[model samples]
Target: MGEATHGLIDGARHAFVSPGVHWLALLLLCSAYLQGAFDKLRDFGGAVAEMRRFGLAPAAPWAVAVIGLELAASGLILSGWHRWLGALMLAAFTVAANFMAGRFWTAPKAQRGPMTNTFFEHWGLAGGFMLVAWHDLGGHLGV
Candidate 1:
């Protein structure tokens, strides 16, 4: 690449590596969990209904557990304290939730397409959480 091209690449890399940007990226990744937890807390009855819809027995307890996990895990992640643990918790949660909620394989043909997309999209997020955990565990490339 030309010098100017290299310079542009370097600049972009620097911007991406900034601490503030790193925090923002993590915040973006955990935003959904945070929002969901808060929403569940705000509407406890609705949360229990959701748990029942997902076929979780003793729906109220499941709802409470999910709300607690989401908040605690996301908090640990954002705070960068035991972040690896947080990432792993979120990763496992994502996969479990995906299976329970994103049953695209059994969907009607017309609904299959969108459901499949959402299902895979969530898998991708779970993978991202795994990567975050890996990096937090000192598996990152020299950055």
Candidate 2:
């Protein structure tokens, strides 16, 4: 390799290892993400029932599917298995969850009470996962 190319590679190696930032960031992200996944899993049945109660029975299957996807994605991310792909999937799910929460916030007052609280919690969890996805992507791209 040319001198400049060698230097560039060395710099990346240094960045990837010296500060230990990559692993630390991934650890934080994965930890937070896995926690959210577990939380959602614990309430998956409730989530489906809540959707049905809201007259979104047609979406119950979808809700279940999403929960499955989230669990799978969390597993992949935590294991660093095809990490880039996992991060992308997780990020997409995060965005979709945020959008889905908005619908709950606009429901009738009685329905909105619990949903409003859940929406905010989802919002925060999604934001944290997004950060994890971002950092994971950055590390994979060597940026």
Candidate 3:
């Protein structure tokens, strides 16, 4: 092939290759998304109970609202629509999880442990999600 032809081919190859990285990143994000979604549905009652355990029973409706937000955020991520909004929702989830952890820390000892660990794990997942959102939106949308 001529020099110009080779250059065109190389550019095309790189263009195709770069999006593979983005898809892999999205896959990692989707995996985490699925896990978080499952946790919300699987332990619906326990999550509600944990709110009471953590003395947020007065805000039980708020707890349910958070679950709805999780589902909505996951849906947005899946649809690839309004992704920045999804990122904001995930960030909110992070804050809520951390707040839950703090509440558990001060609760009666017997109601701590496993729940605390789960909440902290959720917090970590949120951090990973922040990176994904940064990659998807911050890099792309500049917001």
Best-matching candidate per TM-score: 1
- Compute each candidate's TM-score over C-alphas: 0.95, 0.51, 0.55
* Stronger candidate by TM-score (2 vs 3): 3
lDDT of each: 0.94, 0.68, 0.70
- Cα lDDT tens digits for candidate 2, 17-46: 744675576666556556655776788777
lDDT agreement of model 3 with the native = 0.70
Model with the higher TM-score, candidate 1 or 2 = 1
Residue 14 miss distance in model 3 (angstroms) = 4.2
Instruction: lDDT winner between 2 and 3, please give it.
Output: 3
Candidate with more favorable, higher TM-score: 1 or 3: 1
lDDT per residue for candidate 1 within 118-140, as digits (tens), equals 99999988998999899998995
RMSD of 2: 8.0
Candidate number of the best lDDT? 1
Clashing pairs in 1: none
